[model samples]
Target: MHGHGYGQPVKQPPHTAWLVFLRVLFVALGILTIGFLTWAMMLRLAAVTRRSLDWGLFVAVLAADILSITLVAIEPGDEIHTTGGYVGILLLLCTLVGTIAYYLAADIRHFLLQQQAYEAQRTAPAYGYPAPAAPYGATTVPTIPTVPTAPGAPGMPSASGPHTPPPMPHARVPQPPQPPLTTPPPQRPAPARIDQVRAELDELSDYLRKQDGPEGGR
Candidate 1:
């Protein structure tokens, strides 16, 4: 993002040797008559943006650059007199242009996206998650698919509202039959002594006869 001049200037120490070393290394990679480094950077940019770049084109460009370099080396003379020499120069020029073009375009795209992100972050609600760690738009946010609500019961197209299950009806179960109860029979009373009863009867008869005799004599 910073490479495109579309990013805000950052405050830091005057300079760092590590940064200078990297810049020199980057220059050496391209100036040594090859765009391998550019292809590497292209891949890096793609990864940072989480977007795919022209991978096949990058490889083709690098291959062309190498072939052109080889041709130029074959004719190291100051003037090029052969057809291959001319094609080599043309291809070399094209590769250089392509390398720079891709780098700038990628850088610019990243920077623009970064600027938009910063603006979004500024306007974002306070309760939202924090932005990326890269303060200079070094990272991109990935999009996630929103989860849909669970589907309800299927209904007819002409249904007025959501389909609901009917309430369960109350059921009454039959009870098992039980055995009948049994009772004991009633008992009879005991009889008195027959001889004693007979003796009493005879005594009463004798007394009655004596009273009758006394009445006749009177």
Candidate 2:
């Protein structure tokens, strides 16, 4: 049968030397921000603090780098050298650098805080009293006392017999009465008159004439 134990093979690291080389290649290809980000990530992994500001700064830096790279890649020629393009590229680079710097500063701050906390813990008084030394002697096992039961007398139910619960009363619920069915009375058709039809036609003609007058005026 299969079982779990600490007998499994050693797992490899998530990032290898080849990955590191590729990251270095990316850095050499004018993506210094990415390299800085990689270093920051390593620091975060090593350190205890996981601050939200640090994560936000990393995302901002990555976005700025991606934007700058996209702009440069799309307009490779003299367009990047133009005033507006140059300014945009410069601003993006500045944003990338600024975010990286902010993240590093936060990391430093967290590191200092952690160090200070560690020092405080090391210097703090030991309030825990040493547990009283376990008695150094032979121990006696505890013994439980036996309880004596009284003898059952005359015709009453014996205590040794299993108990049976009484049957519960069943209740009957009343249902609502159904409505009675009935047939509706038949409807009669009204008789048509030529005078009524002539009046309706006259009204429709007047409405049409009024609508046409507004359109004709327009």
Candidate 3:
């Protein structure tokens, strides 16, 4: 975000436990200016840099070193050697300046912004109780809470109305079963010709008796 249209820097490194420990170690060792280079090498090995290694801070270091050496050599009666204390002092000073500038770079600022947004989103949890809704005959639309997100990321939009739990199904009130009905047994139907049939049967028996008692039986 430093005015012009420069692309974003390398993505932030993963937040693994070991990486976090190493970051803390390198930060402490940064006092001597070697830690920056070491960390840069690690990032390079991890292929995290998109544009420049060490976030282009090494350029400042190089420019400063050359300028310091040239100024020192130009002085009268000064014989500059690679092993001289002047060279070491100059490199350390340049590295320190480069480190400062690196922290102040546009890419670093953007990264820090992203980090803060991520932290804010994480600290404010997403799984809290749903926003409370107004009861029956409510006057206002209840404020439905939503999760927060970092800039440029997907965001949670509040619901048009408050969230309410679904109504529970009504339990069936089971009734005790009723006893079966009882009735008198039905009567047998009376026969229509029973008395007439009995009279005919008696007349036939009398005819048989008269035939057996004939007086003229030869």
Better of 2 and 3 by TM-score: 2
Q: How well does each candidate superpose onto the true structure, as a TM-score?
A: 0.38, 0.36, 0.27
Tens digits of lDDT, candidate 1, 51-95: 545566666766887788788778857889888888888887767
Over 14-101, each residue of candidate 2 has an lDDT whose tens digit, in order, gives: 3345545643453343345433333344234234345565556556555665666566667757556755566557756576455445
| Candidate 3 residue pairs that clash | none
For residues 114-134, could you state the per-residue lDDT of candidate 3 as single tens digits? 667666555653334344566
Colliding pairs, model 1: none
RMSD of each: 19.9, 38.8, 19.1
Show where candidate 3 strays beyond 4 Å: 1-23, 32-49, 52-55, 59-84, 104-108, 116-218
The residue ranges of model 2 lying beyond 4 angstroms of the native Cα positions read 1-48, 125-218
Candidate 2 lDDT (Cα, whole model)?
Answer: 0.55
Candidate whose TM-score is highest: 1
Candidate 2 residue 136 C-alpha distance from true site, Å: 13
Which stretch of 10 consecutive residues in model 1 shows the poorest summed lDDT? 5-14
Q: Judge candidate 3 at residue 206 and give its lDDT.
A: 86
Task: Report lDDT per candidate.
Answer: 0.62, 0.55, 0.53
> Can you give the lDDT of residue 121 in candidate 3?
50
